[model samples]
Target: MEFSAADPGTVRPGGRTARVRAAVLRAAGDTLAERGFAHLDLADIARRAEVGRTTVYRRWGTVTGLVADLLADMAEQSLPRTETGSLLGDLKANARLVQRTLADPRQGALFKAVIAAATCESKTAAALHRFYDTRVKEWAPCVQQAVDRGEVPAGTDVHEVIRAVSAPLYYRLLTCGDGLDEAAADRAAEAAATAARAGVYVLG
Candidate 1:
C-alpha cells in the first residue's frame, strides 16, 4: 500500500506484526538521526529494536528497504493538514509544522541523513519523492478552497502554492545555521499567500 502523509487509514495488520514494525521503524529513525544513512545497518537496527537479526533481514532484505519502510511509516504517522478557513492561516500552519519538525535536533538530523542518502541512492530518492507527494496532496485542498473563495485566480496550482510555503523553511535548514522560528514560518506563509494572490502560482 502507498503510504500517505494524511491518514491513509492504517492498512497495516495489527497485534505483534504492528508492534514489531513500530519498534523496528523507531529504531531505524534513531539510527539515521544519530549515525546518518551511510552507517545504517540492518543488524544494528535489529539490535537496537531488540528484535532478531533474522527477522530484520528476512523482512527488510536490505538497508534501502528498511529506510523506505521507515519513511513510509513516518508519512503514515505524520500530522494531518490543518484547515483554518483562510489561505494564509492554512499556509502558516503548514509552514510552522515544517519548521518545528526540521528544527528539532533528532528529526532534523534524520531528514539530513535521508537527504544525503537520496543524493546517491535512486531508491531512496524515489521514496523521498513519494513522501513529499503524499504531504503535498494532503495540503493541496486548502489552496483549492481559497480559489473557490476567490482568494486566488482560477487554475492556480494549489499544490505548488502549498509547497512554496514550506520551500524556504526547508532551504534555510539545508543552507543556514540560523534558528528556525515562528517569525520565519509566518513570513513564509505571508509570502506564499501574496505570491498566490498575485497569480504567481497560476498555471499558464
Candidate 2:
C-alpha cells in the first residue's frame, strides 16, 4: 500500500513544505512501527523529523489528527488494482498484495499499531474504514467484470466478493499468527472465486 497529503486544498506540491510533511510522516510511521500507538508523541516525531515542534503542533494539531492524515496519505498512495481479465487472477493479485504487506515486519507492525488504536478511537476507526474502502473499491471492478462475462450471477454483490478474497488473509494476520504465504493468498482467491461462481455473494 502507498501513502498522500492530508488536505488537497492546503497542500502544495514539490516544495519545502512537501519535504517537511514527508519527513514528519516517515518519522511517524517509524515510531508507530517501532513502539506502537500508545507511545506516538508529536513532539518526539517532530524531533525525529528534524522539524520544529511548533510546526508539528500547528499543522497536525493533535496525535489523532496526525494519524488521520497519515492514513489518508496511505490510502492515496495505495497501488492501483491489477487487471488480469479473470476474477481469480485479479483476486490472487489483490490477495498477494495484502499478504506481502502483512508479512513485512515494519509495515505489519505499523498496521497492527494503527488497528489497535482504531479499536477505541473513533477518528482512527473512520480512517481505517476509509483505507479499506479505498482498496476494496479499487479492486471491486474485477468481480463486476466476472459478472459481465457470465462467470457469476448478475446480482452478485461485487464488493463483498472482493472483500471475501482478503478477509481470510487478514484473519490469519490478526488471529492465527501464521505466515502469509503465496499459498494462503492463492487459497483466498480461489475460495472467493468459487463462492462468487456459486452465487454465494448474490443479492436478493
Candidate 3:
C-alpha cells in the first residue's frame, strides 16, 4: 500500500492560480499535521506557503473557507478508480489506496485534524461529508460494474459497499494504535466483496 504523492489535502493543478492554491493547500496540510486545526492561522500559512497573507485572506476569508477549498482541490486531484475488471480486484485497489493514505504519517495526522475540526464546525462538517461523497462517487461505478457482471444482486447499495470497505480501516486508524498494513487492507476488501456478494448491501 503505497501512499499517493497527493493526498486529500494536497493537489497540484496547472496555471498560476492553481499553483498558488496547491502551495497554500500544501502548507495548510503541513500545518494541520504539525499543529492541528486549532492552531491554523492564515498569516502563518501564507508565510509557510511563501504567498502574501493579503492574498490568502482576500481569497479565503477564514480557515474553514481555506479548508473547504483544500478539500475541493483534493477531490479534484484524487486518482480515478482503478478498473481491475473484477469486483474483488477493484475493491482491493480501493482498499489499498485508503490503507496507504491512513498509514502515511502526514496524511493520517492531517485527516485527524480535519475530522476533529469538522466535529465542531458545521461548515467544515459539510465539507468533510462532501469530500467523502466525492470519493465514494468516484468508486461507485466499480460496484455498478460488478452488478452488470452478475457479481452482486440488483439494487445493491453501491455507496454502502464502498463505504463498508473503508469504515473499519478508519475505525482502526482512529482507535487502535496498530499500524495500517496491507493485510488489513486485503481483509477490508474481502469483507466488502463478500458482503456485496451476499446481498448485504441490497436496499430493502
By lDDT, the best candidate is 3
lDDT of each: 0.84, 0.83, 0.86
TM-scores, one per candidate: 0.93, 0.92, 0.94
Model 1 misplaced regions, further than 4 Å? 1-14
- Per-candidate Cα RMSD to the true structure, in Å, reads 3.4, 3.5, 2.3
Lowest-lDDT window of 10 residues in candidate 2?
Answer: 1-10
Clashing pairs in 3: none
Tell me which of candidates 1 and 2 scores higher on TM-score. Answer: 1
Candidate ranking under lDDT, highest first, comes to 3, 1, 2
lDDT by residue for model 1 (1-204), tens: 111132222456689878788788888888888999999999999999899999999999999998888888778677888889999998988988888888878887888899889999999999988888878888899899999999999999998998898888878888993768889988999999999999999888
Error of 1 at 34 (Å): 0.5
Off by over 4 Å in 2: 1-13
Candidate 1 lDDT for residue 45: 91
lDDT of 3: 0.86
Better candidate by TM-score, 1 or 3? 3
Q: What TM-score does prediction 2 earn?
A: 0.92
